[model samples]
Target: MEAKKRTKIIDVLGSTSVGTQVLVKGWVRTFRNNQFIALNDGSTINNIQGVVDFTTTDEKILKRITTGACISITGEVVESKGKGQSVEIKVDQLEILGDADADKYPLQPKRHSLEFLREIAHLRVRTNTFSAIYRMRHAMIFAVHKFFTEKGFFNIHTPIITGSDAEGAGEMFKVTNLDLENLPKTVEGHIDFKEDFFGKETNLTVSGQLEVETACMALSEVYTFGPTFRAENSNTSRHLAEFWMIEPEMAFYDINDNMDLAEEFLKYLTNYALDNCKDDLEFLNNRAVEEDKQKPQQERAEMTLLERLKFVVENDFVRLTYTEAIDILKNSKPNKKKKFQYLINEWGADLQSEHERYLVEKHFKKPVILCDYPKDIKAFYMRLNEDGKTVAAMDVLFPGIGEIIGGAQREERYDVLKGKIEKMGIPEEDLWWYMDLRKFGSAPHSGFGLGFERLMLFVTGMGNIRDVIPFPRTPDNAEF
Candidate 1:
């Protein structure tokens, strides 16, 4: 009688009955002298150790097998002697599916710099660090959907291309089809946008908050999880030209409620990743954080994935008004050199990244929710507070990652919004549809935009934004 083929190594390990025959297919991560093969089935971060005795295996065929070679194996579960984990597989039969050239393949056993790995973005996912990061990213995405879906929020798809600029920062990647040779031009040789794709002009969306507000007015609670593009020329670890943003808009909500929701959502996501992607997170903690000693102790805590997550989930996030934060910064230790970073003492100046990082990582020592930013520094749609000079906007700052969430209570009063738009010199005609929301039956609504990549960065302990995303799009680098 023929021996029955079994399930994957992952499933076999979970079963009570050891020594069960199994058929597993995976790429060879490492191979040793026709005696053993370390294979990964992509089922989990843990690779199943396969022991193949050379006496039974063909030496000629074993010579052809190399790292990264695809193969299928019929094996029996056995105890592992290796340091990786408890389980291993004793191979009964091995079949090489495809050969991988040891010299030509870019990935080697030695560590490669992230910069070099980025150049070969197509193959980086196969690496342990990137593989773990991408898996955690997938888990994080699902967790986001689950969190919003359970809360009765509607998932709305906002347009990628829009006629009106979302952020009004004038940093947009233009979309046009006017050929240079046959372009429509005015008498002075300036290109005319009248003949362009949208008849006027259009560009990729910077945020979906505006459109999400429109949907929230109808659905009462709506969110947009989509790709947002910005043409800003910032070359930093925190900035990306094209990235994902999660904009959740709620009707009849205040800034406080918005902050609460942002805090809850983040806690949920971190918990979800901790619960669902334990192995991957462990791999990241051991492999990624171990190399960087500068990583904070709170970030490096070895609490079982869930424990680390529960720390944030169960605890109340620290809250500080922008005014209070400014006061704290002013009263910080009497170091003259450190004071230079806080030079913009007065209100209205945009909070710099360094200030944000210091506030969360140093002052708060936990996730900090900073609210009531200066109206002049905030977006036009934010609701003005009773103070008259500040707006009801908030940013949630995490320890390693700064400003994971930026949100505000929107201006619901038509007159106030119109006046603000006019004062900002924005053409009212362009925002007619947005104004309509207030004109009809606008109630006080609030929302926030969470940078998805930054969240991934926090979860994976990845320092650079480019390292988290599969294919990073930057000013000069857009390679696949």
Candidate 2:
């Protein structure tokens, strides 16, 4: 006879199809009471219990049903009498597809610290915390695409390697195929970039905003979602050497318009995760609550994960100028008492993470959008304000995550942009094409770059950026 068709554990556990013989395959989470097994196939966090008759079942088969062991169960689905689950499998037959030596398996059916899980990154996804995080990551990604698609924005693919520095931050990872053992030097003994593959210096792109703007000029609205790299050596929990970024550029948009789109996009994503990934969110929310219990009272989050997400979606973000923010921080208790590592003493000083957290978490007590930053502190492409001292830049700061979105109304005047480029000492020749967009057909355009992992950190209540991303790439660490 042909073998019974296989069914996923999610389907079997979620449905009320009784008296049906279904084959379910998954790893054994635990073997309880010697006759009941909790099986999970990563379809959901909740595991289905498989009931076995210890009187007839072979002792050897039961002994192999340990944690992390893969097994196939041909059983009848029936209403469960368990406390937490509604249904379970009444096993007619059980076969061990793969045995996980209980003594050797790294993952046991117990709580593991996030740091320990990072060491065993490959196997961490099977854990309840990671599984829930990754599932929510997928939901957030889908929500990003859906929000832009519904808004009629064209999703544009930008090149990964380029010869230009869009942000002008000079923190780019060099991309070259030249043999480092051998030397290609000029008359002055400087390494010659002309001998490189691109004929000039090239590096992994830091942002796709510049290229996306060219597309937006014609398409009206365009966005690029791709991996971006930075060569910064900071090993903080928030920094990543390689991360995904979402940049949306729109023509005919000023600073205010950019802020509006960003706010709406974030709110939509929060609502989407609440609706689509309810189970995963609940698990993560509870996990966060448990994790917070170990910390001191002051260090814990004021609101739960679910409540925080809801708060962002339901409330309007506070908007203020960078000057106002600086004033607030200068007068705040931290600055007054010298509690801040970098004191906010002046108006043009760039706000550090601690200052930003204060503005969002304490001062405003909501999401804060601070615009019109000092021109010297912002990028060269940002539109300069009428005062000629500040640029129309905006940063959306969240309670726990500082500066989740950074963008500005772009400088569209050809002469003004060229002047800024020259003033900043950026190679005018390398950015001739970028300048061309402003030369031929210039329009008021604004855009912002959202760090995808940073958003994931907020949505999942994950303290470290590495936990949200599947495989994190950081300074001196690239292990799978």
| RMSD of candidates 1 onward, in order | 2.8, 1.5
The true-versus-predicted C-alpha distance at residue 286 of model 1, in Å, is 1.9
Best by TM-score: 2
Compose the digit string of candidate 2's lDDT tens values, residues 1-480: 212888887788777488877898999999988999999998888898999999999999999999999999988888899889888889989999999999999999898888899899999999989988888888888999999999999999999999888888899999898889996999999989899988888999999999889899999999999999999999899999999999999999999999999999999998999999888999999989999999999889888999889878878999999999988999999999999999988888988889998988888888989999999999999999999999999999987788899999999999899899889899899988899999888999999999999999999999999899888899889997
lDDT, candidate 1, equals: 0.82
* Cα-based lDDT for every prediction: 0.82, 0.91
lDDT of 2 at 196: 91
- Indicate the TM-score of model 1: 0.93
